[model samples]
Target: MATSPGSDIAFASQKSMPSENLRTKKLPLSEEEVFYMNCRAVYLTVFKSSLENIISKDQLYLALQHAGRNPSQKTIDKYWTPQTAKLNFDDFCVILRKEKPTSKAELLKSFKQLDVNDDGYILHTDLYKFLTKRGEKMTPEEVNTIINLPNINADGKFDYIKFCKLYMTTSGQCLKTALERLQVDSKQRRQQFGSHMEELPARDPSSVLKPSPRILRNSDQETLSNRGDPRASLLSTARKFKASVTCTISMAANGNQNAKLTEPNLKDWPGVQSRGCFFLEDDGETVSHQYRLHMAQRSTVHLTIKPLNLSQVEGKLSPWSSVDTALYILKENEDQVDPQLVCFTDLQHREGFGWTGELTPGLYRLLPSTSGCRLRKERTPEPEEAQLVCRDDAGDLFLTQAFKAALSDVFDVIDLDGNGFLSLEEYNFFELRTSGEKCGEEAWLLCREHFDTKKNELTRQGFMDLHLMEANDREGDPCDLWVTLRAMGYNRALELKEACPFVIDLHAERCKPRLKAVRMEASRGQLEKATCQSVLLQGEARAMDGYENVLVHTRSWDFRITSVIENKSDNKVIIHINNELSKNCVNNRGLNVFAVEVAPQSSMVCQHVMPLNEHQEWVHHCVYSLISS
Candidate 1:
């Protein structure tokens, strides 16, 4: 008899089935492959070939229970709810293939792959394609902006160096990259324009990018005068005394107390154009005044004083009243003399009697309106209290200079043996005394491993190296522990109960599950029956085991699950729903499908009858529709 093709195929399969099974048994599946197979089986069993299959809460619960996989409600909501609780072929592939570059080298490799042209740069189009493949939906404008970042080349291309710098750091916002590029550009501009702007005013050292104010010169005065401005006269007069002056003055207020005076001069005064003038008066109402007033150069005048009796005056003299003195500056091309009020004062009161105004640099004369009036240059007492206050303020100088000096002091104190070296025991003692905390066993071990030798315990250099290494690992302060303690002051160090509060040890071991557990009670009956037009079912199935325990809420149809039965042989589940309301508009009996209609005011119970997997799929659809609504 001749064998058909189908029959031949079947006979061959039967003959090779045992060998295939043996081979399969010998080669165990990998964990990832096994997981994929399980997921595929669950998907096929629940959805079959239907494109619009939905997994309801109860159905999903049963499926998960059968598969022996339980996931939290939060996980389910995060991954499933946003997709309407349905898994399409694309979504299934996404869940299985989701991954990201784990290292800088891997990211750079991927970036190079995106450079399709074999050039050293990535263009805008390539970047857009790369981001799109990674499931990032970006607009053309956004892609252009990213590709045209300041760090990128002018031709809108990304180089490997800049790309690596941008992604290698934890802060990937590209701010640092932009700032670096900005600094480079600024330097380039400065170099290019430095020669052309050589005449620009120099910047002050104390401030950044600020030019010092220009001093007015004789040339400036000439320039202003050529412009026919009134300020030219003032400027000319102000600049004439910019040279040195030689003048002296003395004051004898009571004839018995005479005070010598410093030479009134403009030699040391760079911007000053005027100085105070002084005179002396006697108690017998006699006045004597002297002034070295000149228009071109310095001059001196000495006057002899004659005493006047105030009782001989025509009008009665009040004891508290004093004569008014005035000084005036002679103005050029004018008959009137401008009062140099600011330069005049009574010797007794040490203040102007009538007027006080600024006296510009010019010719001036001192005159007294009545007797017993003279200018006085009072001998100001030394400010010893002020000097003491300043000395107290100088105490803060330690804050600026104490870092190095205090470090030296601490090092000497810590070197108890005075051998210029610190043993492990000595270092520990110093640490305990300074910070109130002992070094860890691992720290000591690490120090020994790196720096310990047969002869030397730890030299100064070796100790510094070990300390720096530890500080770097723990992100601690780089300053010496003893030095930091001394800088903080003894009183402040005593106030701190714990040691090294500022140092954070990132490598220290911590308990499992670093995040704290938060208790979240499921919300029940939050939505009223009248307000709820649909039902919401949530929670885990494997959490409930093979039982039908679930959180169910309903609104329009006042229904509840009365009982649930599962058939293990056929993999079928039966859910019986009971209506709470006595009067109902729809027939509520035996629902073999997800949705059903019933006669109004009829039976108060309903049954959803379907295969176990099919029932779960139908419930998924119902839940999805409810959520979407």
Candidate 2:
């Protein structure tokens, strides 16, 4: 009996705990069941953050999905009206399990709702965001199971009709093997792709900064605390010779009590620094004041704030040194605003932050706190302006010699009448053509107040000064200046690089000069600057037409200057005219020593110039040239 019992005991198998019919190795699962399980796993993963079995509306928002797409937040709000709405695990399962066979019209309407851009197709990014960031979120792995459908293009995008036919309308029973393959492919792709970690939201820079109390004198602070300033918040102290305010900017209430601002970096700007910028800030909890320096040389600057502390860095801004701030520099010329926000984070051991750039004489603005948000949220703060007025000292040469030389050439090119200054109209015309920006009248007035000018127009010196101010604000970087130079037809060598396409018809009412056959010649000029040639054409005075009669045939930009004459008067007349090359014109191969006399009604052709080299498009750098009589 003992021997038989030992042999039977060795071979006999015990029963499985849960079920006798199920495989011991794994549970028997259908394709739909596995997908539903994946969905449940995602729901659990997202719910883990709340550390609760129950889910709120937002939690549900992160879980709802249909055919790998999530309903919009607006749709969720339409149904889940209560803010404190909750759903248990069973309820969530019921919601996920419920689905109706949608008709073609209903599907089309749904697709139309998602296709807000009406692009006919949905972008991969849009789909991903919809499934993962909208009313209910889904895992990328699960979403990709559908994304790997045969219809998806190399770009991971496709028409909604394809999605409907493949994932929505198709029977789950038929998609078993394909779905299984898709799951495997998606997992392999994810493995090859790298990290699937969701990035945390961007940290607000202002979060690191201790909200500073307003900057004010002791008496002023006390007065402000008692009963706000009777005067406007934006006070003006725009005197030229005023003493600089204390460099130390009093700190606001910072998070770390240990960060003690022992000293200031100093107001070490290049020019005479005068700041009378004033403003105020009131957090919901407390009231304080903020101020920007007034860069007043003349007209007042309107300030605006973008509520957000924009972070230039993408992620992991850690162990930030003491709380820091930055300067936003702006140039206010009426409607012209070039806002620059600069931040020089202090070293770990440094006491405070300072922006130590030198400046030239002109109106400048410093705007801090760029908008951190794409849309305006109630929480983000607006941008504030500080008035910082800096003037050039007696001995300081603001513009470098080379820059001045180049700008002098630029001024001459803009002065169409060969006059010594640029009218606002002329400046705006050139600006619109070259930069696609129009200089507003307010900006013009601002320039007049700050820079040297004659006839209420921009003088050559003033032009140079404006550029100097721009260069200094950028810490002597010549990038912006170079753009203007090139646009104005100047080369790297500061030589005129192109012929001005515009003609300044100064005396057009009487006689107009025009370059005929605007199309460049077959043999283009080899260089950017137009080539010029001159030979004195001897002609006797005779009855002829005036300036309108001269036809300038521009061939290969070979000719730079031509005079047009037309006789508007009934009486025939002989006129004496001068043929001269502008001292400012580039690549001038002609001389100005000849005077030509023409018979009335007869055309007088000055020496026609041709390009020296015959294979490039040349723009005559003569922005303006004059033929005088």
Candidate 3:
């Protein structure tokens, strides 16, 4: 028989009859197995704290000695080393001081008290006393600079209000910096606390906190004596097992109280903030909005939110949640709307794709793997929407010409006759009346036949009256022809009025200053304005058409003014007229003054009354030369 080494087993027992039992009851031999065995034994003991509690170096060394590690003092210093303790002493006090002061009034009072000097200002001398009283040793110059800021009153007094404000602002800035640093340090501590430790689940379903065995053991006798219900026998047994204990035992419970405790004060880890733009479209118009959010790094994102119902979204086309749906709706309802949607993440990167389908208005969430998104209305220009009115000084070219072409198509459809002019009757086909007075049903039908389908071409003058002029019934005057021409889109209508030639025929009885009569020929453009200019030539009396005619020219701006001659029948007719600058100066290239005069009862013509400057294009010069030729 042999005894096991280092154990107190007697050699006699080894040789005894329990050999089979000893062989069956062997202990675990690995370090982990041994530690767990010791842990179990310690758990059974009356231990007052958690297994994760910090163990002192001496206690740890004692345990190591129990396991047979007997190194020298210096070696043990390296082995049983103490950690650099966390700098959290008075941490709450530090936090308290870092908090912003609540009441500004108190700070101002304190500042005023610290000012010390009865003299209105706090100077270097004043600050010395103040700092000494406060046990602070700031430089006098710094104190003086603070006290002497521009905000000091006109009397050079450092008001306590200003001083308190400045001090609060400066102190808050310093506190903010310090707190930021402290926060970073605290975050690092939290990371280190969890770094090497076994991970705890965010939630625990199996463990509950219960009273330790000591409480059961101490309460067992009393619990058994007072047990009123037979169903509480287990509770009585539990009482017998634990007494006078406040231990938080981690064990499985069937109820819902098994989860681990979490602090509500703790915040989620800060992540990156990103912004994206999105659009809402209604009818043909699209409005935009931006989405900014803080997102977890390297994590999946699930966004589901409703669109903002902005007031600017009013229109026939409602903003659809999905771009594809909106596009489909736009195409299907082309007769109703020309819908477009545009998205822009970056202005510089404008390559966009569209979806072909109709989408109804509602909220939709976009799911993307990336950090941000931007959607905006695709700014599609409808040049055809621009009014069809012609440009006077210059015709619409390039983009405008495209618009004009569309208008021309519309006009062709409206003009029924193949004639080169749009008559008043033909113009009525488009629901545009030629006169203020209502026309008959026959006139409307005739207009449709002549203008709506005939695709007739209309002259510019006829077009002006048919499309542009509005009937003006003021001062018994027929109409304002110039306004109509303007609305009709002729830029040079004024110039046209100035350039229209006029002729007048006058007849009178001989010598008695008899009643005078005169007749004039006026263009349609002139007649629109109800004005005409004519010169009366001085010559021998002749038949109504035989009066000697002298050519003279006249230009007028006010259409209302009509010139008349007196005593036209008797004596020889003498010319008395005025020369004036014609308004129809097409070549407004530079400064100019032109003159025109019309003889009495005479025909007149004046053409090309415009000034050309050095800046005028060579093309203009060529046109002028051609016209002159």
lDDT of each: 0.29, 0.34, 0.25
The sequence of per-residue lDDT tens digits that candidate 2 reaches over residues 1-629 is: 00112222121111112223222554456444454444444343334322244445555654543122234444344434454345454444434433222444555556666677887677778767776675435556545544443333347574666544433322231123223333444343232111121122244433321211211111222211101110110010001001111011111222234432232322331122111111111111111111233332332121122112112357532121111222233333556543332222111123222233333334443322211111111232422321122336753336656566656655654554446788886665455434546667766776777678898888888777666665555555455555565444444565442322111110111111121111111111111111111111211122221233332322211122232223333423222222222222222213222222233443333232222222333223211111112
Report residue 452 deviation for candidate 1 (angstroms): 47
Once superposed on the true structure, which residue ranges of model 1 sit more than 4 Å away at CA?
Answer: 1-80, 83-101, 128-136, 171-485, 488-629
Question: What tens digits encode model 3's per-residue C-alpha lDDT throughout 381-433?
Answer: 42222233443455321223433333343344333333345444444332221
What TM-score does structure 2 among the candidates reach? 0.22
What lDDT is obtained when candidate 3 is compared to the true structure? 0.25
For this target, which candidate reaches the highest lDDT against the unseen true structure? 2
TM agreement with the true structure for every prediction: 0.18, 0.22, 0.18
Top-TM-score structure, candidate number: 2
lDDT of 1 by residue, 1-629 (tens): 01123322110001111124323544554444344444443343334332433456444433332232222233234335543545443343233232111344644565666667767687755666754444424445444434543333457576754545432331221222222333334332232121122123444434322111211111222221112111111122111111111111121222212221222332332221111111121111122221223333222221111111123247664222222332221222245333323222212212122222233334444332221111121234422211000112533211212333333333443443445666555555555434445555565555555654334366655544443343333234333333334322221222211111110000101111111101111111211110121112221111112122221232111011111111122222212122221121122122212311122221111221111221121121111000000
Tell how far residue 289 is off in model 2, in angstroms.
50
Residue 615, candidate 2: Cα error in Å is 17
Arrange candidates by lDDT, descending. Answer: 2, 1, 3
